[model samples]
Target: MDKAPDEAKEVYSHHGVIVKKLEKYNERESACSSSTFISFVSSGTLSVLEHNNDRWLLWVPEERNLSVESDPTEWEVVNTEKPKPPSINDEKLESRKIWINVKDLKSLQLRRNTNKMFFDLKDGTTFDVVFQHGDAQQFISSFRSFVILERSRRSRQKFYVKGCVNRELSKSFAELDLFGEQGNLVARFMKDLHDRPFETTLTAFSKLTGVVASGLSNTLRPDDEMVSQPSLQGDEYEVIPSTLDHPAMSLPPRPTIKRGDPLSVEEWMRHVQEDGSVIKVDTLLMTIFRGGIDPVLRYDVWKYLLNYIPYNCSQTEAAELRKKKIQEYQTLCQQWRSITPEQEDRFSLFKDRKSLISKDVNRTDRTIDYFAGDDNPNLESLNNILMSYMMYNFDLGYVQGMSDLLSPILMLMDNEHDAFWCFVGFMEKVMGNFMLEQTSMKEQLLQLACLLQILDPVLANYLNSHESGNLFFCFRWLLVLFKREFTNDDIMVIWEVLWTDLPCRNFHLLLCIAILETEREEIMANENGLSDILAHVNSLSMNIDREAILSKAEAMYMQLLSNAEQLPIMACVTLGLPVPPDPETGDHEEHLKLSNMTPSDDDEDAFEKAMSHTFL
Candidate 1:
């Protein structure tokens, strides 16, 4: 009666699967449709079927003739047919059949609590499926049999197709013109391996072999070995290696500095006079640098640290400024809020930005109770602030990680006006990281590489020889200021400390150095290449010791100062220190502060030239 369903080889089938949510991408519109939650009691059957040499994950309503027996493992196929290609005109059929080619799957995220599995496709369509009868593990195991699925190191619930990842990597490497038109450096090197046998080539090969062996070992490792080992905790901190281990390097041993208690309410009050003018600003900054401001004082201290309130403003002046800022923020918000449907139709860029902001805000920090739950009002505040900011600085516009930076500020301030202005202040400090060209970000990475060379030449050499000299692994850390690496509580402390800008400018780079020093042994012992290094660094997320890293960075700062004269001029310039006269010529060279250079300015060219010559 149904034209006899096309016969196909069924690999696996699971019944009682329900489509909880569906979000489809409109190819003509170039935007995703709003997610629609399915409420009707429509149970479905999910099957992995092979047809025409391709595997597809097909889901069809159980109302169709296909049915599963009471055992759940046996299926009675009566009128089963391969789903036809999706069409824009047939809404009913589109909703009835959901087909995803296994090759197009970008990532899969599992929610164990709700038995939900989110499928993210390369075409930007998403499906949230819930298992009404059983967990998703059986389906996941069946799917894994067709593709090499590797669990993401950063997110435990996420799995990526190894083939897709490898293809992307291969494409990227192919695009790089490393050795110019002559030939690809890697290919040329390999071809002449026997002829040259250069030490650098040998070292590169050794690293590559180690990376492959390590990857194989990890993939084949037993389940017991996959269990995480206990990490050092409590009062024990990682030991810093002796500087004397490297020849011709002489520096003071790392100092032991105990972190002080957070600035208390009484201490903070002593710093603020009765008139509300902060007294002894330098002392206050140092106190915050040594130990972050207390959580209770963040609401007040953050205003000063973020420059929302002038240090010299009295109580009355502060109140007036607050009122004025509120008016300004409202005006900005109204600019975006007042846009009509007719206007949005013509303003594609505006619409696109709004769409992106909406999506990012929806998922920003839903795990946190403050922003969790459906229809949370706080999520609206986040969206409004970011939208207003788009109007405030239309040129910069919205970027992906901007939400990560805003979530904490919103959580702490808990008010639109204060949080908006505080976020503005924070953006001003790190805006370069979001530039179109990312020039400032590259400069920071290079500066970090140069600093590493001065601090630990061995590690620097290892990275450089292994094609990781760019230090791109730390991009996320610098981009969002370690927001992803640390817990919300830890980031609250880390961000405030960084905002103080005490000890030195670009002290965040020093924190990177501290982390590398802590992990130097493992990195070197394992001979990690670029990929391995990136994986290792990413796996460090949420496990770093806040106080230990801060103390080590501060101690390293002091060590650099102790040996400042002997340090390279590039190192001195990077740290914002005055460069000494040339040792041989007894002449002073102009110092360029790398932290202040931006791509929009002419100094960027000078910065690039300086970096090139320093490395040469």
Candidate 2:
């Protein structure tokens, strides 16, 4: 184990630490690589000290005088960019060192099959921290806590500035040089050190000071009567004045919109049309995953999502493809319906599948306006699409919950051909869920159970006592993608986000975990049996919060990454991550854990912070 600095500044520290830097990559690319490394000081004792409540400062000693001791409080910043001085010169002076703010960190990522930890920075720098597994875990936990405290401090600071700005504004501004054209100089300094977005930092400043654009004055007339006059447009535009607006102050920079908010219809369409003909797939997916598509845009967005329209095709090409698909669908349907009564009867399985399809179509989402009523044409069309789907894929045929999946697609794409093709694209992603043997569904349940076991051992054991260990209760959610658990609008939101396939694969499973975690306290407190748990889960139909599910699901994804090494093979496969090879057999090992825990809100906050650091 690597020892702490001999002359410690802060009395105590986590030992056996190794640190290395990451090679740069495009922001959109993976963070799995750590090729570049930072060398440690060869002669002096390395130190990790509490820089403050929110940061950890690392110091590397330079000169060697055994009898002399250095003060912990005295430290110098090491600029790694500078060239090494002459070897004859004091080597200790050139020793590498840097200060790390806990909140400014991106992630503490572990390289698979290695005992190395990567400390990622918000400015796209990654450093490998070499430590024993146990020590690394402890250090990471403490670091994570400091990060949380820093975030909480930031939130409080936003309000704290608001609380006593009157007394401090003038004095603090002058002392901080927050005057004239430029705004708060202190904010700029803090922003550079923290490496957070300027908009985010500025928003906090604005909230504290109650100023919009700098403390500059507005030119608009004060009288409310002239506020709406049309002639005052352009250069003569009216500006709303406020208390902080002074003639001596210059205007503040225009505020940018929150990056993580859902894409509006205008933004969605403009992004899609940006490349003119070919759509930017990564850009589109990133936008969707950040928040989700607006409801109004789904009608057009669903085509790209379902792959009914090729992402790289031009507007003219898409139109041509759609026209061609329509003909093919009609032709396929015409042949199926043209079969003589005797010919159709000869195919015994067709009749059985058709009977099952009719039953499911009628039983599914009858309360929704789109599918409601005894003799509705929409319902009739839905039946036709399902039957048509069966004809298109005779081998798979009509399954029980297939209608549930098809209903929403049909509802959104009212055109018969488009609806059928969109459902086909959706089915491609979910085909395993509909298999008669349910091989995929069984695997998913096993994965979910394993995740619960690792994340919440207590919950897993409790579930075992109640005979719900197999997680059969989540079958419906996996099968139809939780179509039954939310309103039409909410379901669309969920589906669109899922279609993005961002962050990770099998996000729906994480969503199921999120929903389960939400109800954990209820189940645990009630001492609920498997039957009670099942009933409670079923009762959650149409009552789930779409935003809450997305948020929690994202948190679970981060938590999964946090403990990636200990994860089972199935869990790794479910999350689309690489599985480590076993030492004994020279093959990847597969195992399962039998525990579960309900994630707290802090997980989401940490996940958001990590994401901002890594991607922003």
Candidate 3:
């Protein structure tokens, strides 16, 4: 490593460390490309330096003529005793140097029976490094001196840092007896404090101070009023005037909704005619909207929902369509499979796409039995489907989240041709999310923000005031349609419901609102900023109540309908409801005209147009 600056303090230094893997972080995209890859064996020196009162972990590659003395903290120049000018290669190597803020480190995983360690950062950057000389113990010992490291209970190999102030706060809160006899609330608060430091601090202080003020107010109240208000609730005791307490800020009472049982094989068969053509398509869709198809029935029902098999087709026609589709799929698959080594060598984009597809396929849903185990046939099927998709839709090619979208379909279909077509059908509805400019993704987030503002302004305002108005924290939820937020089976139900496009257009946005509503109190109580919100939202993966969220989202739709007359045109457009006539114009033509205008128009017109296209 380079010598520390005169004003810097060197805490630790180690030599013979090699960076096995390094990739740039992109929160929205999980796919890795060739440009981001580092050579397998880039030998370097790792050092921890304290500068400007903040510590940093840095790695610098070994350079000729650089030498270290017996003292670990000291550095010296050898041979010519003078530094040489850096060449083009040296500049390239210097750009690869790793410099990470110690505080930004989220967790570290030490591989068992090996000297390699994986470092994960809060911003999603990851580093795979191996100690070439001694083991990683020496570095871990040095790191413990700067921060408190605790092994994760769930993962024996993982260690995370805990701040001293957070630990002290937890201890202080645990000793307090003010909460209650059981102190359950205090225990919960302490646990939250330990998990999230800054946000928990603000929330705890806010609630505690409110309680203190409320107690003082209650003590000063007249005996007559206390006797007269014996049935008053805690919120009714507040004497403060706050905007959030205003009646206009309150949402409609949530309606109770119960989900139906899954669509069984018998019920599904009842809808089919002797010709194999489905009858009462609208009723069938409604049945699916209320309750997802049974897993055993998904193989047959999904094809119809995905439009892979036309509902109006007879048995013979459906069989013919299947044969044609299989042939077409095979042709597409062969396009890339037939690419010669020489051709791939020259076609960088094709090679990159193939490389990304292969990498993602190897890791996609590996824990699932259908796709697990080394050399699993399902893995190859996934790779083939994605590669075929690239040939089928060359413009869109393969994106990071595509694997997630296809895995379930392939597993359910258990056939490569059907899964490929089903994936294409599913992609048709969501292809906008994977576009190069990500215009659809941004529009979805904007629509989600708009909905939240109308449905729950209090939470929306909180987010706006805290620099989270963009709602980017919910990006993963929208991008993969909540694939990461629910269990495998639950995701299937959610996807089937969304595919129906019933109840309203962009119902998925309402789902986002529903989840936010469920998390509203905990979020406002424990989260204070964007990062806190993101972490809390991400930690909810696979722990969500799917049926409850689906029911709540549907209830929100009902609430919107009940208040349709008073809602703004933007809200109506977002949910695919009829746009109310403009009072002054006495018709909605002018609004539609404005909404259909080009982006080159003024900002207001552009926003209206964007909102109009949110679901389209």
Candidate 4:
């Protein structure tokens, strides 16, 4: 049966499995005119439980019984109905506004019943996601739907893209680009959540791997007016286009993000609060969305959000230790101010540190001051972002590049509270990179570099010879999650796709894969070295095509030799995501295996790297 009967009055999830009943069907010409009663099995296999009254039974995916019945108390029948899937006929994305109709339930049908969710990225590729929602750790234990959205050009950032939360799952469904008509989906799993959803989404898609839709014309030339507008309702805050967008053109049109865009953060929170699990959402996103009319008031809202996440956060008595640590940290900031450069250098955390500033030598005072204070319409926005992020992420004290991440979000969400919360959501996955320990960031760089070497020995050799073997120069690309590369709108698409958690978060490794893939032909021809490769790679900012890179990247993801255990690291490598790699063992399966068991090398290594380093 292609479609179920309308009278399927009952449905529920059974021990991570979905089960439903199809009511009477009195069709006279039907094949099973009398087989009326039907029950959803553990899988797609639907057997005849009770046949009567001119009806038939069916199930999707056809698997054996393994479903646990719902709790009696939780099983209640209501008048809610299941909607049909939407049909998009040869749709083409234009100017980056591929809006999925919110009120239309039919449009949300891209979810594949077989897995939690599916994405057909392009032509013939497909991907699967075991989505999660709720408390961070419980995410794996609880498989809510997830999806990643892409947002960047010549760079990348990933965001979680999905529908509004619904009653049954208590979370919204993620949307994805379906490909291959059927069965062709495959990409490296990008990210996982031990923190907020936005963090997971943002980290997974972080990349500076491709030429985004903005900043480049079809001919691979810099489009003079390529300066991107704000993501949502970015009209009022449009600053004159930065000279960075085009060197030759004196002024590019300040691309503006109009508020009229569907499902802005404002709408997301409203729907989030409407019906769903009571997630510990970033009050910042909420405040920004609520007070969008006057983004100037975001600072006030930031103070309010500072209330949402208690500064001295002691959720339990064990957390009291957190307060003492905070005091110790504040003491360090104070002590550092008085210390000389050499004195502070002794402490690894402050050595040669640059406070949230760019390393780009050419950037002028106008560049820094332009975005810094009241002159920058987004200055207040940036303040709220930096301040709230500082309060929210004490583990990673304020660092360079974080402002890049905040600036984009600030552009999209003028309100500091909202920007702060969205940034918090973003930082959940990224903050680890900014931490004093710096191990996660180091591990990610190494992992990506390793992937690049494995995937492209030629390029690896070139980079190696030039002292770029570590590929650490890509640090900026990773640090702000590629904010330095693409325009803000591009960041949204990249991020939305990443949030899905499909393939898993280490998806950026795929970017490394894709970058190598796209340049394979060129690398083969150029015979470049590490230094030459560095220059070539850096100069690719305007010559890339987002679609081509992603397609190649998706292909690379399918070819990589990843393991279930490596999925965590894989997630991190995708978007500057912070997957500590079990600093002890440098493994994940061991962590899962030893979760409640004895410590191994991985445990010791993690302890040594994250904790003992304090002594170092």
lDDT for every model?
Answer: 0.66, 0.55, 0.67, 0.36
TM-score: model 1 vs. ground truth: 0.59
lDDT tens digits by residue: candidate 4, 549-587:
545554555444333233333323343333344555667
lDDT of 3 by residue, 139-224 (tens): 76667655446556456567765321233333333433221222333344322222212222222222222222122223221221
lDDT of 2: 0.55
Tell me the lDDT of model 4 at 458: 61
Tens digits of per-residue lDDT, candidate 2, 290-332, equal 7787777777788888888877787888888999998888887
State the lDDT at 105 in candidate 1: 70
Which of candidates 2 and 3 is the stronger one according to lDDT?
3
Task: Rank candidates, TM-score, best first.
Answer: 3, 1, 2, 4
- Score candidate 4 by lDDT: 0.36
Cα lDDT tens digits for candidate 1, 390-484? 89998878866788899999999999999999999999999987764455665576567656766787887687666565565676688789888
Cα error, candidate 4, residue 128 (Å): 63
Name the Cα RMSD for model 2.
26.6
Q: Give candidate 2's TM-score.
A: 0.53
> Candidate 1: what lDDT?
0.66
Q: What C-alpha root-mean-square deviation, in Å, does candidate 1 show against the real structure?
A: 18.7
Worst 10 residues of 1 by lDDT: 192-201
